[model samples]
Target: MEKPLLVTDFLDRARRYYGDREAIVATTGDRYTYDEFGARADGFAAALADRGIEKGDRVAVLDPNTHYHLEAAYGIMQLGAVHTPLNYRLVPDDFEYILEDAGVDAIYADYEHAEKIEAVRDEVPTETFVTNDTDAVDGDWESFDELVDTDETFERPKMDENDVITINYTSGTTGDPKGVCRTHRTETLHAYIVSLHQEIRDDDVYLWTLPMFHVNGWGHIFAVTGMGATHVCTRGVDAGGIFEAIRTEDVTYLCGAPTVLNMLVDYYERHDVATTGDRDVRIATAGSAPPEAVIRAVEDDFGWYLKHVYGATETGPLITTSDARRFFEDGSDARFAVKKRQGLGYLGTEVRVVDEDGTDVPEDDATLGEVVVRGNQVMDRYWNKPEATEEAFTDRIEGYYHTGDLATVDENGMIAIRDRKKDIIISGGENISSIELEDTLYEHDAVADVAVIPAPSSEWGETPKAFVVPTSGDPDEPGTDVDELVSFTRAHLATYKAVSKVEFVESLPTTATGKVQKYELRQREWDEEDRMIGEG
Candidate 1:
């Protein structure tokens, strides 16, 4: 007999083989077995069916990292429903647009994010709302624990590799968020890529630092779960909390952005954390390329292995990795330097660097070009947006997913990102669009022209900072309120995307063609760093 090639099928096999093994370790010291996790998933599936959720339906989950959230994801996917996770930090307006745009049938929220969803409940098409926390929520909603008490066993829905398993919404670096539709084939293939580079093992204890909503937590939910590794869940990205989890849970592996890694390094240096159960821990970071200094600190100071990777929401989110070489032990700085560049494509992934003319650039590490990829793990399409999806796949490239990232490829085939072709601000791994922020800022009566860019932030890695050339009021007006402009924009846009700092400039530097030179603005802020994109 052959096995079904599906994400849910892998979960069932893990349960059958590693039934007694610990599946999840919560921050509050709660643990669940594979059997318990599987049963909870079954119960949740039955409850969703009871609520009239059918196959191919969309169920949005807005929560922090938790055991129940993981079960909710699996439970929804097992029944052939699309599991969509939302960023809890997004403001109500953002949530309102996404919930309605995605046509979510139901939402399973954490206690912290329940209020935001409640405020806009009537606008969205969501038919049901459930919470992991029971107290003080709406009367209509049901408790997560209560739903999991059902005795009904869920029969796995018959699904093919091409069936859409999840619809991950991008971080909205442009206008309205576009959903990246990924099938079971892509998810399963991405998991294999992660397992190969991340070196997944049955004994590895994985910690959840990255948000589950971010590329299916970098596709580790499938890879780690399939390998039967223990998942240690943390409520927030607290450096102390992470170290404590690593120590107590004996966590061997974790994934995060550069901001998360910097926070841990800073915390370790301040608190002087020596060891985790007499052994060092390992971490994987993505988003912006990490600085060589931070990479060295993770290896030398914190005694943790750090791997740099690059990907986007449309690219199955794991295209390349800068895995450390074993020869770095020979005290060669060159080996460490090579490991800093995002390494070549993972197995089954094809990557290329090409100029605007569609010509492949020489791998001299100086010829900059757009990075594109085609792989088994790449997304199938942008949901309901055929034109946008076609545009993304078209251009000079033939049968490739355009990444819209400007980068340089070295002779060794390692890729170093240079700039973004799109005006996207990546602060702490959250992708924010300059166009979106500028549009909101334009609503201000006092505003004239606005240009936004990624400004360096120690805490957030990069925050949105605005440069404004005021309207015809005054050249040097003392009464110009910057906070007032910021507040006005915050009212329209999400809180995370709001401008943290604003400067009144006489005029922005532009090219001869009359376009704002964002590169010049970014260069001024990031001049001191080795790379324009700060690793933090």
Candidate 2:
């Protein structure tokens, strides 16, 4: 009755009960059962132990969605070493910062990305540089295949549930990247909640469309594995490969950001492809709130169920889901509005939309406030940054994690994110939600993707500018023009909310996790301005 909740328990349970079941389908097309996966994890642990790695030592893993990523993760955790995963898309400078900040003793990088680490080998504190393919890489890297063939057994150090087991670095959009420290209990509970909401079944087939480095694939590494599901791995995300995998592997469940949804929709529209096989596919989209038009295309056009969740990296990466079945009784049309909202918080999590004074906002669906949450799944603190940790939890209110995301809660207690606190555009003495403007533009057929940001205006102090990625895939040959899009937005929304300027672009700048980088857009608009913040 008093069993400890350890992240290692997930793999242990799977190996014990679902040992014979397929655990992972490697990017190389090889399959491994849970027994084999567990054995490999043991081998990795032994290899780390042979290199004098002990409990609490930071071990960084930089790779894509591959079998070795999972093996290295659980293997590092088995020895109670802190599992520090790096964003594979990060450059050598970022890698150096994280490796130095975390004081990583060793790093296991994929052959594709190991060169980034080797580029700054002398600057980082990381000593043991191992890669999947030593021959493929330029540096003197050890072969991962040979390392995992260790014959020695590792002694697992005793770990407490509250011990810091993982440290995930933030995207550093605001400032220097701070390491978010999490305990075993936090990850274990977050995995359980994700399993409950995502409705992962043992027979379900999961596709690795999401980056495994992204919050440990948004904690699916444990939730999916613990459920005894089949993992179809991929080196990178491709719409064509995703479709082929679904039709061939019978993928029933997957997760991605709104950008991924847009890519799939664009791909599906240009080509005639079967969306799913015999399995009823469920896709969980987060990183950012999806537009209603995109959500409709995903459900009506692609015939796939979309669950919209919301949270940041420090907040378990998943604290809310929009998969409430009761709201979809009227059919797919009703589900669009419901799924468009971020919906309710997961069980045991307290989510609230609070005003600047730390008071809760009324659920009239009109008032805007910052979202705050408190749960076991939330991160404990920033690694070695106590001041940053204090500011995060005690910003607006004490003890509650301040999300910094502006939102509005409905009558049913479902929260819909309006815009980020810094991204909200104030023009001509009126507050404008950038997300609302983006959603209005997305309804136009010519608009493939769009991002709205505030530009400095002498007339109104600040006015909204639209960056549109058209369907033609050519910025010069965009299917739509400025006057047309402006009039289109004016007809759909209020005059003040309409975009003042429009620019057509081939693509939008996005983070490694696929979230659109709105700050980058803002930086360009305010490059000649005196200050970063715009005046109302």
Candidate 3:
């Protein structure tokens, strides 16, 4: 008996097995059981069908983490339409490019962000505009609640596992964001992997700290729902709001980037709040290897376990997790050490750090190579970009997807990312990891946030430079001495790896997901130079 694998099965399972369970706690103070939530999804699906949204139609969803976003995702997929999630942080121009690029036919936007879509609605090919809050919206938009108020049932369309389920756009550091196409099989398999690795249980209560637009909340929407766990939705990530949700909902698990974790830690310290609660909360962090200092604070100060995972938009957005329970149980400093690395390849993923020739690098923990992966969870292709798709998979090893990240494999097969290929600083033939330098600087009490980039230097070709956001001082004026910060890094890292100069900035430019945009900084430094690659 062979049945097709589909992401919709997650919702179906919850509807059947956990109908009476509290399925969602929305920020609007609304609570719904699994039965009610499933019905809403069905109603939304029927409404889309009534509106002539057929199978394979590209439907974009633009919102922060909210109940409407979650229901819209399932409803869109139920109607066999492609779920295209838009980054809420992007501008109207960015939305215009994505809507045009994805050939989106319809959009379901949040009231907070409907104006961005409305501004470009005339330029794109989209014909239908739906919003969760029609009263707040000022354009020709359908009310999401009105549509879902019906008791109509939706017919399940025949779907194959290979059918494209969603189109996730990348952050587009250098150019317009690329649409990463994912299939039902890839998304479902990644959800199972996430469930197993994150230890998601039926009783688990998941807090929506990560944006649902990012890789479908890193596939937690399916993973948590499929496990019959409860979802606590927040409009956005705020320190006080997150703590209140965790305390009120008895949240068991959540995911976020390092920046979010840092914000939570700072809030906890300043307000003298406690992370302890009735249930133990586990957090999964990615978007960069969290500094060891941040990991320690998360575990020790916050009283929560931090699991550092790694992946990209093209790779199901989840490939590795640093559970490292065996090492952490030893009760030594090695516990934090293991949690800091990217850890081993995920259960069904095959990750390898390889050189230019596609040969695996030595597991000596020093050799840097591009990270390539071959797995069912990898995305199928880039939507409407054959040349880019070919370049992503064809140039690398026969069947593996090349991740632009550079990393080193240790003897234990643990993968530690050194830097992105472009972010690596080469000073006098020495390779320096900007991440390592930033991690060391994060340990400083005065440092609030930091980004390390290569600065053009006459003596060493290019040297590491730190962009510092001080905790309690004016960035424009003298607060934290640059010499003191440089000395701090030199004491922890090699002399050459230490930042040669420091630039005090109000804040680092980041993507919507809180990932620092190093390319912008690199462009400023190399605008007058002939090449971006540091002289060796």
Clashing pairs in 3: none
Which 10-residue span in candidate 1 carries the lowest summed lDDT?
326-335
Runs of candidate 1 with Cα error greater than 4 angstroms are 1-4, 324-327, 472-475, 510-514
- For model 1, how does the per-residue alpha-carbon lDDT over 404-426 read when each residue is reduced to its tens digit? 88889887788888777888888
Q: List TM-score per model, in order.
A: 0.95, 0.81, 0.81
Error of 3 at 322 (Å): 1.3
lDDT per residue for candidate 2 within 359-392, as digits (tens), equals 9999999898989999999998999989988988
Evaluated with TM-score, which candidate comes out highest? 1
How badly does each model clash, as a count of residue pairs?
A: 0, 0, 0
Top candidate on lDDT is 2
Q: Give the clashing residue pairs of candidate 2, or none.
A: none
Rank candidates, lDDT, best first. Answer: 2, 3, 1
